[model samples]
Target chain A: MKQSGTIVEKQYFTYGAAPDRLQLESGAVLGPVTIAYETFGTLNRDRDNVILIAHAFSGDSHVAGHYPTDREGDKPGWWDFMVGPGKGIDTDKYFVICPNILGSCMGSTGPKSINPETQKPYGLDFPMMTIGDMVTTQKALLDHLGISELRAVVGGSVGGMQVLEWCVRFPEMIRSAVPIATTMRHSALAIAFNEIARQSIMADPKWNNGDYYGGDFPRMGLAVARMVGHVTYLSDEAMRRKFGRRLQDKEAFSFGFFDGDFQVESYLRYQGSKFVDRFDANSLLYITKAADYFDVVDRVTASGPLKGGDLQKVKYLVISYSSDWLYPTYQAKELVQALKRTGQDVSFCEIEADCGHDAFLIPDERLTTLVKGFIDGVG
Target chain B: MKQSGTIVEKQYFTYGAAPDRLQLESGAVLGPVTIAYETFGTLNRDRDNVILIAHAFSGDSHVAGHYPTDREGDKPGWWDFMVGPGKGIDTDKYFVICPNILGSCMGSTGPKSINPETQKPYGLDFPMMTIGDMVTTQKALLDHLGISELRAVVGGSVGGMQVLEWCVRFPEMIRSAVPIATTMRHSALAIAFNEIARQSIMADPKWNNGDYYGGDFPRMGLAVARMVGHVTYLSDEAMRRKFGRRLQDKEAFSFGFFDGDFQVESYLRYQGSKFVDRFDANSLLYITKAADYFDVVDRVTASGPLKGGDLQKVKYLVISYSSDWLYPTYQAKELVQALKRTGQDVSFCEIEADCGHDAFLIPDERLTTLVKGFIDGVG
Candidate 1:
């Protein structure tokens, strides 16, 4: 099958029986978990060219290419800029697999998914998930795809956390790993932002304790949360260049009530309002919690790095942006240091960019070149 | 009267009524404005020993001493650390006057204050206020007190903005000016955070377009806003030191729904929940908007610096905390540069503190010394 241009459809892979349900990090189990995914490029006969792609907190299975033209807006995939036939991931040379994680709202078994026991939407009934559980669900999907070994796993931000988890969990199963603009564990500052975002959502009475499905969603709170998130994702320099002290419409200060005096305020309001239409508030709460719980130190200390094997088998490429304060260069350095201690083959680079944590999602020639070079080296 | 130790009573100064209403920067007028204030130390016969103390966004007129014990939870002044009899502002040597700004909710003419015409709270009906308007009203209070000139004006953060306004609007009347941890204008980053806070409050249906008084207030939204504000007030290092990966009420991650796993989350929630009790949401909206409109550049360029006189008579001591990214040291430096350009007598200091933008509010020996020395030199 030719895999290029756009993903025309979403695919699902389901597994795990009642007795052999997927065990979560919290000692809970989820049965018959369904994984929503999309793929690009042809799987080689050897099946060794399968590259698993994990997504960030708000991202879904649509990693690249335009959705079907029949869909309104016909928007391209979230990572459409990077994953294509001749792009950084090089779909022509490698089969790229992007899966919606366990607790995401997009076409995956999440809080919105129907519970087998109740035959109704899980809502808040969905068991709490962790980064480890998300990785395990993806691994199950890969197993069902008849792919025993993988070419690589790549992701940024929360996705990057999954990349790290993959390398440590199944050392020999992967050929390479690329985790960009992510931390092994969230800093208190990062967690604080996440907490505020969660509070914004929960504070909205419309949320109704996350059971507002088929009713009024917590759009207001979700928008505010997204607005806060957008601010963190862009650097101060970028915001200054983009919005500065420029006022919206009016040349002078309104000195009016709750008006958008600065262009940045108007921009944020727009961002927040627009975000609510495409995202789920409860999913945001769960995914951010999972990211917050991601701690490589804890994982390593509990089960030791790579168990009884050398980490040399897994090639690692760690990239961070200069202006990504959310997961700053220091965080990437910390992750690289951990890998180095395990005698892993690791290459790290801090890209010079002022786009902050969201730089990985934007198109940059330097990032493209680095990714291309790193992936080629893995071959 | 011994104006020392605990404050036994609150004083009120009423001015600008009916036809002689206080004209705002927006050309709106407010009448019969009452300024609630507190005074410390004795005013000498010369009356030239009066030092005006401006408060920050959420601060009140109570700059020092505890409230009367008759009231429950009679709290000490917000700036009790820096403005005691023997402290930084030195009540022993100079009489200190602190007035709740016109647009503040704490015993002042604000959104919560009754609209004399409507016989109900002004709510959103209150005219939009600026930092300049706040200073203008405070000047009215000073005029009512028979004070012709001020020995100095001291403030930090939004309070600092008021101090800057005092120096610019009444240059000859101020002997010295001390503006700490403040910016001449709000940066896009700063404005973005404030906008998020405002949006969080407005999102609540209970806000009722800022007319929620005599009903359930938008406590939830206001609390979330406070959480966002609290995050910006502390530095990453301070947060790390205070709540580094420490879970709340558990040894490890609960992976439960909305449990506030991290200690920082718990702290923020507590901060948010407690803030709503003492603060009015509408007041927060107005005060923050006022801070956003505080552009010293606009003042300078519009009327030209120092107008018809020299600025050499007004000594300036501008201070910034090392970790105050909300209104970073660079912003303070910018304010100093503006003063220097006009041949003004200016002193600037960046106090080495890890407490972030709130360093000025917290007790620090270095800050106290700098403040005391600056005030002493004013004489």
Candidate 2:
């Protein structure tokens, strides 16, 4: 079977047209929002067969398969290893839908997207948004697709936050949620890292107070930010195993002036440089702030219809990693406890992995078994 | 016992004065090099009643005591808590010598120092030095002080690296040594963090290829670098316990926007800004590079006079904090094993502490006991 033989034609849906617009969690209204999404597998007679897959930070709507224009050996969609036929997320079994989240730069309307009124990119003019606001846009896209109820929804990192948001705001719409390696709220350590990254970007004069559109971008600052993000994504053990103190290019260590460099340093520099090419600096600020502001427990339990000890109708399969210091296992258990208190069906698993926060994105046998069993078991 | 009443009059000793100038580890010759240092307590006639205290990155020779001009409520020396009459490394029992490490801007011939040849700040023109070079300068300072031997040498972090270097390069000059929260060489993870910090500093246009001296400094870039350094110096548990998700001012979270900031964010920003006042961005680059290039095992075991299995004349105490993930206990153990292989008398301890790499700087009773007992027992 050609799991990745399908051409990835970008599909978009516009919302907030006229009177009924998208109201953000901050009560701000987005004029007209566009969502870029991709679909895999055929929709069954019952639209309930649709499953929504959310992408993480630095992720996009391309979750599986290869575009027709791609050459041989070119990388497929982000989760092609896990979402192809007979894979963990098995596109053959479910019609998968992945959207380039709102406020992101990949074909979606975001800071770089032209503001309909000013005829210029939004830049910092882009209204502040929360994970809930992102979920609202996904919900509207589902509404347009006539997908009332989802078979399941899955995401890791920021994408996982979207899964939690979907469960909170539209519980009756989701059958099960798999929030992998993510937290309901960031800890101080996490916030500190994000702040450092944001500071790196804003420090660049080229940022020009977020109005550098159609001009020189804050490439250097954004690269530094990406370097920080890359460090957080990998565990110390993983890094040691991968690079250790090994010098770049297997060069001999010079006794004088320290000419040789560590492999890890160059690897991160490459990751940082690569990120600047595909991402917008302003989107990073907005998205990271949204992530820092995410507090599902507070949003739900603090004076909401789905308050603590209240009923939750969706089943949750929460997954965390052993070495994921960014979010860690304790945070996942805390989220599970919150769900259990709400009398919701919650299954928590702390998968032992040395890969840190990015483990969910990497293909693992146990992750495959757990996610496949959990989502497949869900009606 | 006016432990902190001793005025901190920074005394300078010039070496490399013409004919027999100091030779750097990198094979470069430095001329008219000066070391800024201070001594606590009186050096007895025996001279062996002396100890050396090395400082960490971002630290100066100010190991203890308040300057005479310092008013009430003013902060004392960095390690005033551990270096007073009745404290660890007791100045009452033995005189202590601390010189600002070479290649640092703390009154040392660093990148910010004027080039004798060019009559301008060296900046990028400054020659790179290794941890060994730093050790060499400390030796020169000790030699100039008319001290032939040291009763003990104690330091943590980069200071700890110096202790190890001293033992390796000048084993007969020290009777005992304490190296805390340090590694034989940097792990890939540690190198990655340092790279991020360097990248943050270099990203600023104000850095201007390290030629911004006597001009608009890279304050913003240096601040971001300090922020990254601050995060690494702290443990996750410490940050969580200190700040958690508490907002900066404890205000209601606006639904439409995130006005309430996490306390951690503001605290980091403040730290970043405060560091800009004291540190030189180019000096940070040089010192950190010196640290990354430190490899005691490679220096000692790989083609050196004091090769592995050779005799080491000094007793060694290696200490690491339980939560100091930057230079974790495992790294300390590795260093210990290397020493033991060389027939060196070594004692190792992984102290239980929630604080991270900066645990030694904090006033901890256990650290006090361990350091005090180690130094005194040597005599």
Docking class of 2: medium
Q: After aligning candidate 2 to the native by TM-score, how far in Å is the CA of B83 from where it should be?
A: 0.7
lDDT at A192 for candidate 1?
94
List DockQ, one per candidate, in order. Answer: 0.81, 0.65
> What lDDT tens digits, residue by residue, belong to model 2 across residues A75-187?
88998778877888887888999999899999888989988879999987888888888898899899899899898999999999999989878877889999999999888
Backbone collisions counted per model? 0, 2
Quote the lDDT for A45 in model 1.
93
Write the residue-wise lDDT of candidate 2 on B1-379 in tens digits: 3334667778888888777777777787877788899889889888888999999999999999887777777788999889978788787778899999888888989989998889999888888788888888888888888998988888999999998888878887779989999988888898898989988888888998899987999999999999999999999999999888888876845432224377888888899989999999998998888898888876545323444546556798999999999999998988888777666688999999988889999998888998888888995
Tell me how far the alpha carbon of residue B31 in candidate 1 is from the true structure, in angstroms, after superposition: 1.1
> After TM-score superposition, what is the CA distance of residue B100 in candidate 2 from its true location, in Å?
0.4
Which residue ranges in model 1 land beyond 4 Å of their true spot? A1-4, A70-73, A300-306, A309-312, B1-8, B70-75, B301-306, B309-312
- Cα lDDT of model 1 by residue, B262-289, tens digit: 9999999999999999999999999989
Model 1, A141-214: lDDT tens digits are: 88888888877889999999999899778867988899999999999999999999998999998888888888
